[model samples]
Target chain A: MDHNKRYEICFSKEKDLGEFLKEAKGLNYSSFVFFEINDVLDIGEIETDFRVFKGIEIHKKDIGDIKSDISTYRSKVDYLAVKARDNRVKEVLSKDKRVDCLVDCFGRRNDFDYVVAENCKRNDVAIEFNFGKLLRCSGYERSMLVRKFHRSLKLVRKYGSPLILTMKPSTVFDLRGFREFFSLIKSIGFSKEDLIYSNNYFKRLIERNCEFDKDEFVEPGIEKV
Target chain B: MRFRKPSLEDKKRYIGFYIESEERLGRKEVLNELWSTGLSFLGEAEMAETGFWVHDCFDDQLIVEVRDGYVDEILAVVSLVNEIKNERVRLDLLGVAGTIRKLKKSFILNQEK
Candidate 1:
């Protein structure tokens, strides 16, 4: 993990892709990951120094359907995020190596707990702290979400699990720099060290995916000897 | 009048921030939202304790001066001010310094990159 550089993962609408890249670079993000919300997939030719990545985010769906979607999309993209609304889905995704991130832990207090945290840690599925969702709410709802965040971070830290942070920015305005992101979440018990680990874990994820994509690679332990 | 010793003087910090938004933002609108956000997040007691103040906002950058020990608290509040006048905005911490002059010279003007 180059501590000097930071990375962000955000969601983008089709029209905002160009400006999103510009804002991300201006904010000093070394890398930007995008999960297109719509059919705006013309992302091939953006002239910029920053490394851009494309990903898939699966929202709340039936367990069997979600599993099929995961299998279908997992190998195709370097990043796969599953929104596990059901505990069964969460359990399945927690142990699934194909899924890079398990999200939608916004169900007040029922979503994430110690068991999920431990399983995610043991199986290497990262639990995500989606910041853009937090930015969209206000008043009581926002405060309630922050309280849930406080609780969730406590459980995540207690289990020593891998944590990842993403903005899910729909527009350019939703993106934020590293320090500000750190400070805002720190109030809810996230530490600077945790932030570094999250960012570095993400960095490693990209590298590992790149290696996994090469023709010579078979799986984690063995290459095509 | 016996001045408080330099060592005993209240140490301060100036936090430089860049506001990222689609439209232009003015100091008045930004400051108003900041105060409200800080007040709501920290409440009146902590807000008073930190003694937060905005030095200036220009060219989409702003400097917030807070007590040395309270920098993080003020930062949290500033980060929470995600909107100003119905416009979505993001506040990114550019840098923080012991003096406003250094913060301005290094961060606002951004001589070093």
Candidate 2:
């Protein structure tokens, strides 16, 4: 593996796709995962020189709705993320292997229990750490967010749950280079190697999805060559 | 003057980084804001221990000198600085070295490329 390469798994609601792609190249991001793609934003019309992956974020009220959204969008998108705000939603998302990631663990009010962590490990759903919150929040809120992340990190370590690092950039301003992203997460007790592991998880996710899309692919362990 | 012991000398690290923004920024502006933000994020006691200094600034690029073991804390503080004077900006790390010579050889020389 080319260890120098860094992958950004989430960039959301980009206004100018073309410009963002150019910037992404300059930043040396090997791959980018853009969320909430629509018809107006044509992926084909734009360039695909960089490894770009499409993802849909599920922000629903209940677990049932989240599951439905995941099922609906799973095959269509390269990555699928659920915005887990509370324990109930987190629990529901964690138990499902189809769900790729569970994000927003440090929302205004959220719960991250050991059971949820173990569930994520069991089901292979990665827990996301968005550095955008660290950039945006300050004072007491930022401290609380850091503490929450620490708690989550501890649980993740204990349960061996996959951890993914995303900038969660809404605008170009929020976009950060790999080193900056690495340093920020490193400060939060995430080692550089952990960041690499998380990115590899996303890479594997994309590869798995691509395999399923192939015509010869029949089922798990049964592919028509 | 008596020669200072190597062990007694502060084991400092030179970190090379650059700022990305729409408009060009003066060195003073970037340095001042970095210090202020560092103070705010790390507070007085921690900031003092960090011994952070803007050793050099050219164009949008800056080389910051910080004591060893405090680089990550200083980096965390720098990441928190998203905006300066209401202008959006990002501080990206280039490389870190124990001495200025190596840092320049690696980051400064290749910065143009």
Judged by lDDT, which candidate is best?
2
Worst 10 residues of 1 chain A by lDDT: A35-44
Flag regions of model 2 displaced more than 4 Å: A37-41, B1-7, B98-102
Q: On residues A64-181, what C-alpha lDDT tens digit does candidate 1 reach at each position? A: 8778877777666767788776777788788888888888865754568777889889888898888766667777887887787788888888898888876766776676666677
Evaluated at residue B49, the lDDT of candidate 1 is 89
Q: Native contacts retained by model 2, as a fraction? A: 0.57
Q: How do the residues A119-155 of candidate 2 rate in per-residue lDDT, one tens digit apiece?
A: 9999899998887887777878878888988888999
True contact recovery of candidate 1: 0.61
Instruction: Give the Cα lDDT of each candidate.
Output: 0.78, 0.80
- Chain A vs. true chain A, TM-score per model, equals 0.92, 0.91
